[model samples]
Target: MTTTRPIQSGRRYRRIIYALIGVGIASLLGGMFLDYSLAGLVVYAVTAVGALALTLFLQFGSEIELQDEREREIGRRASDVTFQLFGYLGLVVFVAMFLLEATSQYTMTARAETLLYAYAVICLTWGGIYVVFRYRS
Candidate 1:
């Protein structure tokens, strides 16, 4: 008789969490494209709540050690790069939109205005966080 090793509980839990996240994303995307019925709204709300609960459980409830120090360092570097890249890209796009409106008859759309406001907020938040961190460190 062939013997099989049982799966570790931590690994099994991680797989379940990944599957749930995938299903949640798929349902959210499906809900976005389809009609906005009451049932659809309920499904979306449930999915969102489930996802949030899973995230919180992963953060505080579970005893599973997910990432090592190296992994966390890599994640921090990636996050820093992503934040800078998006901030610069948003600034460039906002400036281009503003210049186009200034030079030509093209008027900024509501979406463009929204982007401008979002970029401003992002910059301000980043600056404030930087100041706090700089002073704290």
Candidate 2:
């Protein structure tokens, strides 16, 4: 397909980027809100819904022509970066929490929800950049 510039990316890629960011924020905030002061599997459910919404947007609203090779590659790299950061920090935090829980004889204050929020934030940040670059490309 013909793109505006001599590049394999287009504006639709940006649409996807923004949508993914919305998903990340929804996941992080929903997770935290339901955990810090609220409790239940509601946070998880909301995260799932957020993903679903993104799927719906991509399927219905996002034009398919924009996701060319360059945009896809960019998105892939973004996701990988986000995943690595999330994984490393998540592991460290969990490990530290466990150690503290053991040594201090007190349960860790931060729960699974906290972990999920932090992870979601990373996803949101990466997704935001993906969207921005998608448009700029």
Candidate 3:
């Protein structure tokens, strides 16, 4: 006698996510390159649909056991490391730009200045969350 195991819900969810991403990218490319009048609307609709799917998945993923605790912990650590790396890299770029501007006739563009300010805000928010979590623990 042979026993068959059912497919995992996590695998099904990942496949759905991949399909959504593929459709979204295709729609975006078509919108950019095609001459259709409704191309922009199609792209927007695809993006909205993808976002809704993701929101739903996030809301119910834990309850469904979409990821095991080990997987979830790994994801959390990976995201934390990614954010820390981005913060440090942004700080380096900001300092380099400032130094270049101060030592030469180079002036930072408005967009770059805005990005620096945005980075500052993100870092401050992260710090606040860290403090809250620290005290709560």
Score every model by TM-score.
Answer: 0.72, 0.42, 0.73
Winner of 1 and 3 under lDDT: 3
Residue-wise lDDT of candidate 2 within 15-126, one digit each (tens)?
5556666665665676677664233245445555766675577558855454668768999899789888867887687777678777986575556658667776876887
- What's the candidate order when arranged by decreasing lDDT? 3, 1, 2
Counting clashing residue pairs in each candidate, in order, gives 0, 1, 0
Give candidates' CA RMSD values in order.
4.7, 11.4, 3.8
Candidate 3 lDDT tens digits, 3-111? 4232366556666767776776777667677866377557657776886777486556554445667878999999999998998899898999999999985799999
lDDT of 2: 0.65
Clashes of 3: 0
Top model by lDDT, which number?
Answer: 3
- Evaluate model 2: give its TM-score: 0.42
Q: What local distance difference test score does each model get?
A: 0.74, 0.65, 0.77
Alpha carbon deviation, residue 116, candidate 2 (Å): 6.3
Higher-lDDT candidate among 2 and 3?
A: 3
The C-alpha stretches of model 3 lying farther than 4 A from their native spots are 1-7, 35-41, 50-54, 57-62
